[model samples]
Target: MPALTKILIANRGEIACRIQRTAQALGYRTVAVFSDADADALHVQMADQSVRIGPAAVQQSYLNIPAIIEAARRTGVDAIHPGYGFLSENADFARACQDAGITFIGPSADAIELMGSKRLSKLAMIDAGVPCIQGYQGAEQDDATLSREAQRIGYPLMIKASAGGGGRGMRLVHEPGDLLEQIRTARSEALNGFGSDELILEQALIEPRHVEVQLFGDQHGNLIYLGERDCSIQRRHQKVVEEAPCPVMTESLRQAMGEAALKAGRAVNYVGVGTVEFLLDARGQFYFLEMNTRLQVEHPVTELITGLDLVAWQLNIAEGQVLPLRQDQVQLNGHAMEVRLYAEDPTQVFLPQTGRIDTWQPALGVRIDHGLLEGTTVSPFYDPMLGKLIAHGATREEARRKLLRAVQDTVLLGVRSNQRLLAGLLQHPSFISGQFSTAFISQHFAEHPCLHPHVPCAEELAIAAALFYQARAQAYRQPLAGWRNNASVPLHFNLGLDEQQWSVALDAVPGGAYRIQVADRSLALQVIDCDGRWATLEIDGVRQRHAYHLHAGQLSLFTRPGSLVIEDRTQALVSGQASVSCGTLKAPMDGAIVDVLVTQGSKVSKGQLLVVLEAMKMEHPLKAGIDGVLKRLQVRVGDQVKNRQVLLEVE
Candidate 1:
């Protein structure tokens, strides 16, 4: 077969750019398909050729099989690389590519179909002599049979969507009473996420480590496992951090798990890159979870350890080539850890944050796979993940330390992210000592929160933000008002941060210096250096250089703790209307109202669920923060709302 000369990436954001980079290096022309929302995306700009797929909605664009296949045909590409998510594991898309005489850079349609469904995959594993958790995979879809199966499986069971992964259609029920409701939710989410409502029941393993083996196969029927990744660090069933060479993995355990992974591949005559996930319990017994039939999101850690380009291998395999490396030929190297930087607020229950990234500065001495630019607008239509940071070192401790520094040095302004949270996790004693389970975040961080909270730099940021704004204002004025020979007056400003407001005063000192006072905390600051988007200041005799960005009346000050955004309320304060507070609850972000749990005029207690907002493919339920009567319900199910739009009023 001829080699894949031109390829079309039927995905967007970082994955698209990632595929383009590898394809270009291998002497292949690349084409990128993008939605309306991603017209100015980084991936689109990096590709050799581009095509407009459809609207911002995923169904009309990335997941639109017909459109993607047509784009490949139009570009005259030989193969289509569905870079994970979207249509990557969709058997129909792969089959479509094959029917169109275009290569799909992944496993065969038969392999994907067999492994895509958890129910069928479990049965397949059982037939192949793979140890699987005791659960129900029968075809009975009735609630009575499922409930009976749940009873037989006992309490503390898991309900999962048969059609997909990514924690979308999965839920845990610890009690018999909650099983039915959870099953309903899981089915709804499953059908919406994967177009299938088929459910599967599994015995929930208590605190088992989530380990997966990365394997590759070719048409020659040779399969080899590169290594394993410890994906035990998760939150809300989504993996936040992953590492290669699991801390608890011994030589024997590795060999056993690796063999099982190879057995899984051989069972399906698997080809191309795939991941076989397993749950390793405290006693070292591993049980099959499922198989992912495409390149995984955490593939970088494996790549770093094996020093092999999995994407290059995928291309070669698609060209009907033999396996590049044998089992013995693969050598494990040093340690590597990856942290996903999401556009979210860890403090706010991980609610997705969206806005333009005014300042984008990634740290040095690490590998950053991202699609962010200075003016990148993070829309609510896509995933909240901004990028990923991978750090490699000779030792696990060294890798952890380097990753913590990398997270600290990184500066992403204008949107809230989990940078500080990731830093905190790396410094936690449990993480540092390598003694953690899948429940690490829940047991230590989620309920308790902030294992090592960054010291509060709010006061410093407030003062610096004021000074930066004042400097910008004066720089564009005649004679530079603040630089006058006899500067005697002070500039008064009001800044708002969430519920707290700061009354700040800045007095221009002699020689272009300033004395800033924010609610009695005075700081003697000098502008050591500054540019359009950054500033270096000497505050109270301590020198610190930082990046700052001002856009749409909001100022972002990049500090060691993280980016601090302060809203300029000076005008509102002067107008005497800023101090007013309303009892209306607004939509936290732009999303579709999925469910209205309460009716108008219904009384609600504190923490009572009110409405569910779906954005970035996740559901966030809005609850009442105060006990009151829900006097008005402003939204209904399926209603699309904008950020800060009033969803309800409580009184």
Candidate 2:
């Protein structure tokens, strides 16, 4: 061991907490670096020592190398573990850490620099005799050159950022007409997400399986592959779900891919935990995808089957220790799967949502790596990935079933999430049979019924919400303020959910009962039991129970379908407009306007990109709904907008 004593985790959220867990378990003192937004975060509380680096924005905080180095120096930390994302793959950060006499808990700066660029990595892999996809990875990055290369590489091609992972700076161009625009968008995203705008074009594999091999090496020139993971299921070019021991992989194929990954690692004298991703086709052929120089988000699955702690290995390897397990001894057992839980609305094209989580409850019988707590404010300064939910089983089906149940049991109120979407994916038939590809989601759930079905049981939800509200009111109100003796009068409520409206009248009956009438339907309800946050009720003679939380005039009901947020507009009905005209386009969520694509009086067609709003580090384009001339643009570039705030009017 290289005299390692103290270590600093230079990241935030669950990742920082994850590294801290391993370090603390191994009898090492851990330090946490946080931004202004994460000052009171879970990771900060879990660390032995905490340091505030900078502001909320990532560029000024997590990616601020100088600030992180200074914090490490002040804290007297012996080493720094980047813990994926931020500056994990940054060679300059590693070099700076080395110069500061602080050990960086990863590969050398030269290895990071070599693998950080896709073009350079592809060249290295090709030189090492690894199978690479046929494409243009040249230095000429002009529009004309890229367009010619796109045509030469054929219609369906992928434009990928040379620097960074996580599908941030990636796009697929299907035809010639969309190539230029996609190139521009990809370049813009690349420049913003990574510090580099250089791109590489490759032949798009048609729905191939994304398999990756885990690699571990030590300073003694020893390396071993820890089997493989199938990460084919994706959305927006990023992995959504992952599993180990890819179903179709035979022993021969696994050995082949494993050896190829080992070759790639040996090419750079790699040391530490890394992953070499490959795009495997239906014909059992695999092409080299870029290598990740840091620990992966889905490393838990590999650990579960191998029965080894990858983080501990990384720490020991960083300390110049020999490989703990040899290639012949390392073995895989059983199966493992992991699902990413993101704070995004899959129905809204995976738009990132940010708000205070009034109620947060993780699932049971699963391993959850999260940094969430009740009342935690999920800000828009970083990634929308809340955490990961992992499950292990003797077979894939058992693991899938366990994960599915766990997803259903998870309770998160306030912000919209992909919880329902994840459940849908796990239960999908294609996913169950192990025949899924990268296009699984788009093919099956392009327009699923669960997305937003006709206002989401508006009448039942309205009645439940009103009753819940009345229960809270009774806790502090006059005994008969909302009750009637003769059952002649009922308490009335008008609510709005998105654009849908409801009018509910609830009559108080004996035994704390109620008769509810919403629109043309009438039903009976009884508050059998209530404990502030939960209510067991009899609706139309059918018994049902629900958990609820109310905040800021909004009631969130955790129902079978998921958390249904309803705005109690009973008071607003008397003063607010009955309905606003649909001429203006409003912001769907809180975000900053990055680009105003259309100006006043500009004639725009339906589905034309009119504005671009960025939230949680992802760009979302707000398009025009109807063909009309832009009459007024309310917001300019860089303006922070609230949910439902009108951005522009088309009339």
Candidate 3:
């Protein structure tokens, strides 16, 4: 254990940048490992030095242990910090670093291996009096065996991966008939995501609040719990929003959870920063989930609440320094919340999206940790998380309010994202009151998705749309052809950006108003004010200001950048077929073909899996729409595909 001079970060994205800032603050030189896609990434430029790990695909780059180790070796780094994902919990990587006489900057290989398996960790917890919800974690994992265990647990249960940590390796079963399939899906996802199908069972902890306590340990046998974080605001088990000092927690419950977390950490002799997750029910009872041996994605919430630099602690602990503070000295400050700004389409069930953040600015008084800043590309090969927008306030309500404002002001225009939805969720009554659960997204949700409650043709979006097309048409005419010394010609254009398909259309008219076609009722739009990129107008004769942006050569009227793509009709492709043909399979959008699940001529059933596409660090399973023999596999593993390009054919 010594004062480290150089530390190499073994991951990319904002987390790597976050780790670097802390390490640099402590006077340590930092090196960054980046893939080709991240060559121009902010982290690469921020680090003292950077090395090319491999290609953009995570498997060959960030997740490749040898490449990361080599990056460390080449940089002459004293320690390698696996900043969360790629190999954060990898025991072999830890051992290799140890063998090479370099510190892993995380827990020992034994600690990682012990907690790597849920069954083993649960056993250790149970022995140490850590109460876990009743579920099976034995060796028997067949379909029937898992079914019996699920039934024994209850009608509502959860299937968890033994080695899974993220929301990836888990499934929820609400009915007995759906248990096996859920288990299979969970196991399959676990295998695909973590390279392990080994799973366990647990009580789903119905409608319980998701809470986790942060634990810090050092080699000197000292451990402290840094209170808790309420990551209940989640989608697809992935956290969309998180906050500190859960409003739902009673003082008594907090102490109890904190003590339980310490016991779990001490039992495994955990080192560095880790989080012990728990499911807190309405009645305030809590149950053990698992321990994350690395920094959590939502660690910013903890840092804000405790006002401590966790990355510095990781470095110090790895260098064999005893913790400077004791558990009794820990204090929780004002409320803080973190919203994950992802390149995703919130209007389309939170799908991962990739594009540029053309206008990147968070509201004032908010701490923005952006990975893909303005002019940065949101690549399809990595996690869609562009940055974390965190806000701290005197109270949770104030924090939530500030976070909503931050989201509203962000203006991410390149690809779709849940910016508007995030704003809506932050202001949601249930969310504000802190009444949330895992089923929050799919349950009691809106049947219709609209950026704003009302879409006025005479609004700012309408004006921007008309102006953009008018500008394009003007450019086509002449540099001074449309130069109106007489009068400004009333521009006319049509817009067909019907997001839900059941919605209406618009035929643009002069002076920036439009004739609307929603259902059988056609309305008139009157333009009131035009502000270049924004407009103010009347829908049915009511005026309201709205957000608008010009991106991808089209005028998008305040739409989520993640899901919906607004195409200028003048540039849209016209297909001869009324419907896409039977045999052809096209990609939903532009993304890398991460995995070719089915080969050419592979027989498949309707909805059977074909390829696993990874875009924006999220995995998408492309299923067969019709029962047929596959033909003309257009993509190979690691090939990048685009929107509407035929990925395969079923004859």
Candidate 4:
């Protein structure tokens, strides 16, 4: 076997750290590659050696092929592991590694090329006898053709990018009226993301279970199964909560799926590790979804139950190790569940949140994979996934409970997370009963939404704290603006949180502590630190922590990052279950904003164009969200926004 003394992790964040742990345990050193924004990142500091890839933008750095290969050569690393996403499945990158005499810790270039494109993979699966959803893969970017296919496959069809991956490049057409536009949009996104606008049409499965099997193969031709994970709990076609030994699976079904996975693997002459995703309907019928050729973010669930370190096996296999084990040798034990802690706003359509973490840590339970430290800053240029929290237990229920308990411990003081939504799902009766489907999160949670514990009452706990900080700030004044003199500035302040707003009146109480009244409650508090970003205070015998940040001049309390609790002090301004963001022009899908039509102080009438955003290298006009004078343009040309964020606010 080729000895892998040093492995260069061509990725960042939790996955890099995760690889380091396994490589270290196996007596191998790790090399981490990072972007400019990651200079202080946890993964960079943890690696044995590090290399700076590029500026903060992924195009100039992490996704840059030449940069990755050069780093490997400079570091004298033997192999490169494209953890997941980014360049993980790029066929050209794989071939580049091979040409450079560097082992790519993944499948052969041909496998990625064939399977990377949904059209070819589906053709291969059809020939190999794997069941598939009804749809057409061969076609040009013609709307008429898509409309006809949508009619044949029937309504409720899914438009997917043949060359697209991630949750991007795909959309569902529930009715005939929206089929053509959705297809056009999906194709554009697919082109923008994967550089190929190839589009495919498939029948959308109702009540589908996003189950996938973990498959491994050696150059010697031995293949094995690591059971399956029920990742049915998903948002935007991406998994949120995953559990092992699916609560409704049987041994017979396991054998059938395992064999099918091997067939697909062998078809591509697969190497290293890969995941074959499938969509299983409520009727127990299953169809091929796609093959993820690189290590998956959710690999931990498979490892937890199968008692194997997948990353280790990838390194061994890439180094030309022979098949030391067979399918029968693999075993599934216990139960496992994983929750993704993202720096996102769940209550507001999962908008990517960027800011420094004022307070919080992902809870530990059996295992958790994260890449940020206490003071880490989440950047908008990368994926918002901060870390993953996983738990192992004897039963699924036990694991579910453990995962919930772990989420409650996140004290993320800055930014917002979807933790509360995750907790609600964990506690929901359907979730506990294993009755959840891909539609569960959007259909149920989005409507009712999960509510976290009411903010600590304005009693002696929080109010006294805010007051103390205000007092402390006034006291530490360089000129000492004594309380009496600073009275004109309004010592009374209002802090807005999500769901509830606080109006606080500050009063000095002797010593360093101060007294304040909140919503009819009064108390004394000793403030620890007070800044424009956060307010930390010791209250009511327990240390209570809270964060305050400005969003469009409106204050929001970012209390929990691990949980998706974003308390908006502007809650009163926001009524109904919906959020009232400044009028925004959303990118129909993932695209680059180019040629902002209006600058600061430009006014346009209704239906007037304001910006030109480009996707798939094609220009798209961003119309005004409202008929008002445009002011404060936040994004410039070439800026990237995910899903929704105000592009140009009109007043």
199-229 per-residue lDDT for model 4 (tens digits): 8899989878889998889998888878998
Residue 36 of model 3 has an lDDT of 88
Scored by TM-score, the top model is 1
590-616 in candidate 1: lDDT tens per residue? 999888888988888876778888988
RMSD vs true structure, all candidates: 7.5, 7.5, 8.6, 8.6
- Report lDDT per candidate: 0.85, 0.85, 0.77, 0.77
Taking the tens digit of each residue's C-alpha lDDT, what string does model 3 give over 411-442?
A: 56556776766776787788889888866765
lDDT of 4: 0.77
Error of 3 at 510 (Å): 14
Pairs of residues clashing in candidate 2: none
Candidate 4 lands at a TM-score of 0.80
- Model 4: C-alpha RMSD to truth? 8.6
Point out the higher-scoring one by TM-score: 1 or 4.
1
Q: Give the range of the ten consecutive residues with the poorest summed lDDT in model 1.
A: 573-582
Q: Model 3 compared with the native: what TM-score?
A: 0.80
* Per-residue lDDT of candidate 2, residues 1-651 (tens digit): 557889999988988888899999999999999999998899999999999999999889999999999999999999999999889999999999999999999999999999999999999999999889999888999999998888889968999999857787788888899988988898899999787899999999998999999999899899899999999999877889999989899999999999999999999999999999999999999999989999999999998999998989988888888897889998889889999989887766676889898788787898899988777799998899999999999999989998888887788888888888888899888899999888988898888754643365644564565555565557565774554555586777777776777777777656777677777777777778877577778777888777778666777877653677777777763521111234678887799999987789989887788888887798887776678889898999999999888888887
RMSD (CA, Å), candidate 3 to true, equals: 8.6
